[model samples]
Target chain A: MKAIVPIKRVVDPYAKVKPTADGAGLDSGGAKFEINPFDEIAVEEAVRQKEAGRFTEVVVVSVGKGECEEQLRKALAIGADRAVLLETQEPLDSPAVAKVLSEFVAAEAPHVVLMGKQATDDDNNQAGQMLAAILDWPQATFAAKTDFAADKATVVRETDSGEETLELPYPCLVTTDLRLNEPRYIALPGIIKARSKPLEKRPLASVPAPKSSVVSFAPAPARPPGRKVGSVAELAQAIKDRGVF
Target chain B: MSLLVICFDPSELSQVAGFGASFGTYDVLLLTGEAGNAGASKIHVANLVEVPPADNIGKSVASVAANYTHVAAVSSMRAKDLMARVAGINQSAMITDVVKVFSETEFERPMVAGSVLARVKAESTPIVMTFRPAGFDKTVPGPNGSVESISISDTGRVKRVSTSARQGGRPDLSQAKFVVSGGRPLKDAATFEQVIGGFADKFGAAVGATRAAVDSGIAPNDLQVGQTGKVVAPDLYIAAGISGSTQHMAGIKDSKLIVAINKDGDAPIFDQADLGIVGDLYEVLPELEKALS
Candidate 1:
């Protein structure tokens, strides 16, 4: 069995992202980029599954400009057998990205496609589900725990209500949540080994262009500064004064 | 001319109807399993795509959405999952967690963990969206809307094997009026259940936890309240032992009134709390609970 993990490059979660002066998108200049935290978990899950003998290969894929190769290399270093980059400089929306992934999935027919629940940059949280829709395949989003059978995978998802477990047939898609697993760090030896691993690059022109466009962007509203109360009694009194209780 | 509001759970109809109401002078179509009373203009009872396998739900919705100018639903995990796929099938411009609706074509939503707001304009014909229920006013049940039964074919692919919900009497964290959240200081699951859970029960508040606490296994993943977890905006929020990381603060920033109790006076949560009590939670929590009781 083979697992395909789709990874994304996003502004580091710890860094502050500022809107561009033109208000069209984020300011990319001098900003640090890293593998999306959730996608790292996806890669880690695939690697763990491979180590457990559930998979013979774990292939990591990314869609973006040339800079994305750095992220794919990091995935390779993290134990992915190979890396694929669909080199596209143009920004693609979630639907367009899903379309390209569906095409790839149809051609590759991996046993399972794993990816993050959402990217921190766009925060769309749609790609994996969209991919499932395009393929008419089963999807389990926000997976916290997973178990595999001969031809089925049981996933426990973290939802607004509670944990929901679902059994899906193979050749499905699963999106990883933050709690899925702690991603393992790459050591110096792994980094050196990744240098010799296969990294395939495909032209973006092979995929469909994005249908939706971002017209503008702006900063969020700021909350008012709050003052500290002296004691719990004062806090209760303030709540009473404000008629909140 | 018409707005289709897909209803997965009957209980969420009012919220979905409320979101649909934002499109003034539009018809509301409730697509659900069992046809019940709603405030919408019309109701469609469909059974073929009633449960999980979000793909089937998306297809069912897409079939009806083709006739409407706008499509909306309550931004629950289920709805977002299904509608996102519907958006992909229709190739429509879609947005989720929309906080405000300016019109049928324009809306506002938070981005980058609520630090930036983006006003979006949907150029597509049937603009698809999922509105955060907390962001909208609850819709009052008006004259019983018209009901129509629609047939749907099952795309049997995904199956729900089992569900293990947290056995708790507390209200759901996202929809609770009051939320009592804990942080890393809770130490262990036992302490978290004893202190945080105990206090939450006393106040009839839902239990929430910081990412740190959840990561430490002091709380379950669903109880995590942060940018990466559940975004909650309860009327009253109490923070115990939390130092309020930016991501955590982002989730609860919309809370009507915030009360923070922490040993560290300089905790970032204090800066956002409407009332801050600098003290050890071990002592303060029990004392507060005693006083309230």
Candidate 2:
């Protein structure tokens, strides 16, 4: 069996980024970049599955410009067997990205596809579900815990109200959540070994037109400055003044 | 344009209806309970099991996709997941967590965790999206609308084994008008609950916690309020002990009024708060609770 994990290159989650001066998109110049935090969890889970001998090969794939290969290599250092970069200069929406991934998955035919629930960049939270729909496969998203068996997987999902458990047969998709697993640190030896791993780059065979496009960007409006109160009684008075019980 | 609002949680009904009103007269697909107050021209009821998996719900919604020019739902994890499938099935444009609807085709949504807001345009028909409930007001209830029963078969491959929903009558974190959130300083679950939950219970406010608190196991996963957790925009939000990480602030930036109480006078939360109290929560919260009583 083989597991496919798709990763993305996004601005570091901890770094504070802003929109470009022209209101076009993110001003990522000189900004720190990393594998999207959630996708990192997905990569870690797939590598663990491979280590456990459930899958012989774990491949990490990404769709973006050539710079994306850097993130793909980092995934290799973390234990993925190989990497594939679907090179594209065109901006792709969640639906278009799903279309690209579906075409690749058809030829790869992995038993299971693991993905991050959403990227910290766009935060669309759509690709995995859209891919599952396009592939006509079962999906268990926001999975906090997943147990793999011969033919099916039991997953505990983090929902708004609480947690839910779902079972899906093979050839299914599972999107990782925050509590899934902590990614292992890439050490010197792992980084050195990653250099020898095969990093394949292929031009996107077909890039579907984006259904939705960003028109402009603006910095979020700031909240009015607040005043500090002296004590609890003063705070209570303010709350009462606002009509809050 | 015919808009079809997907109604699930009753608390978010008016918000969704109010948003749909911007697009003109709309109908509803009632998934769970009554939406008599939705103020829609028509309510299409779907016969299904309780809390059906989003995969099944998405398939059901897509089956009737041809009837409306647009489909929308209140933004939530489940609704976003379901709408993605519907978008895929119909090849429609999909947008999530829309904070502003400029028109039927244009919208503004936050990116990079609310630091930047991007205006987007849907270039195609049958647009599928979810609007943030906090960004809009609840629409007033109108005369009862006609109801039509619709058959939606379960065509999903996933099966639900069990669900352990959070207990108690606390209002939902997203819909609550008043919220009290705690931070990591609370230590353990018992202490966190006694302090934060106790304060919230005093005035029937919903309880929330920063990601730091949740990661430390002092709070349940559902109570997390941050970029990756639940986004809340209550009328009044009280923060005790939280330093207000950027992600945490992103979740609460929409809140109408914010009050922060932290011993660290330099905590970032105070910068965004409408009222700041520099003091120890241990001493201040108890006194504030007493004052509220």
Candidate 3:
């Protein structure tokens, strides 16, 4: 069996991001980049499954510009046996991205695909579901836990109501949620070894144009500054003043 | 032009109605297992399709795609997940967690964990989107509109095995007008329930917790409030023991009134709260509870 993981490079979650002065995009200058946290978890899960002798290989795939190769290498260091970069400079919407991935999945025929539920950059949360739709495959999204058997996988999903478990046949897709796993940190030796791992690069294949575009971005409106009351009594009075008591 | 609003929970009909109102005049496609009135020109699909456990509701909606110029649902996880796939199958454009609906093709939504807002235009037909429940007021129930029933074959392949729902009598965090949330400082589950849960019950509020608290097992995952969890815009939001991570702040930024109670005065939540009390919650909570009683 083979497990494929799709990873994305996003602005570091810890760093502050601002809208570009032109309001067309983010002011990414000087911002640090990292493998999207959830995708890191995906790579970790795939690696764990491989370590358990459940798979022969764990392949990490990324779609982006040259910088994305850096993230692919990082995924290798984290435990993926190989990495593939769909090098592209074009801005691809979620559907376009899904189209590219679905094509790749069809050719690769991996037994299972694991990816982050959403990328922090766009927060679209569409790619996994879109890929499932395109591939006509079962998908267990927002997956917190996955119990695998020989022919089926049971995924515990984190839903709005609570946890819902779904059983799907093999050759399925699962999107990682926050609680899935804590990604292991890459050590110096792992980083050094990652440089020697197989990293394949291929140009992005042509796909349909994206139908949606970002027209403008604006800073979120500021919240009114808070006032510190001396005691609980004052806090109660404030709540009462707001007619909320 | 008509609008199709996929119904998940019956209570979500009002949010769908608010979304449909923006289209001037539209029809609602209510999809559910049971039938009910939704105060709109409606088509009820009781078991329109046999939904496989692993299949999304979007597949069924997309299969029946018809004359509607817009398709919408409340921005819950299930709805957003389904609508996104529907958009993919239709090769249409979709925007999620929309806060403003200017037209069938234009909308505004938050990004960067709600720190930035983007106004987007979908230059495609049959726009599919999900509206943030907090962004619009629930429409008042009107005279019953016409309801028609239709059925379709189920193509779902996934099977649901089990569900472990969080047991509670409190109001849903998303629908509640008042909320009381806890953070890491709450310590353990017993204290979380006794303190935060106690306060929520006292004020007739919903219970919420920061991701930190939920991750630590002090609260159930469903009670989490943040960019990754549930976004709430209640009338009153009280943050106790929470330090207010940016993602956590993203969920409550829209609350009409915010109160923070924490021992450390420098917690970021204090800056966002309308009123803040810098003291031990162990002391403050009981005092406030007594005062309210």
- Top TM-score hit: 2
Lowest lDDT 10-residue stretch of candidate 2 chain A: A24-33
Say which docking band candidate 1 falls in: medium
- The docking quality of candidate 1, as DockQ, is 0.64
Candidate lDDT scores, in order, read 0.81, 0.87, 0.82
* C-alpha lDDT (0 to 100) for residue B225 of candidate 3: 95
All candidates' TM-scores? 0.94, 0.97, 0.96
Best candidate according to DockQ: 2
Shift of residue A114 alpha carbon in model 2, Å: 0.8
Ordered from best to worst DockQ, the candidate numbers read 2, 3, 1
Q: After superposition, how far is residue A221 of candidate 2 from its true place, in Å?
A: 0.4
- Backbone clashes in model 1, listed as residue pairs: A220-B116
How far in Å is the alpha carbon of B109 misplaced in model 1? 1.3
Tens-digit lDDT string for candidate 2 (B126-201): 8998888677656675743788887766766789999998858899998899999999999899999899998898
User: Which regions of candidate 1 are displaced past 4 Å?
Assistant: B25-37, B47-50
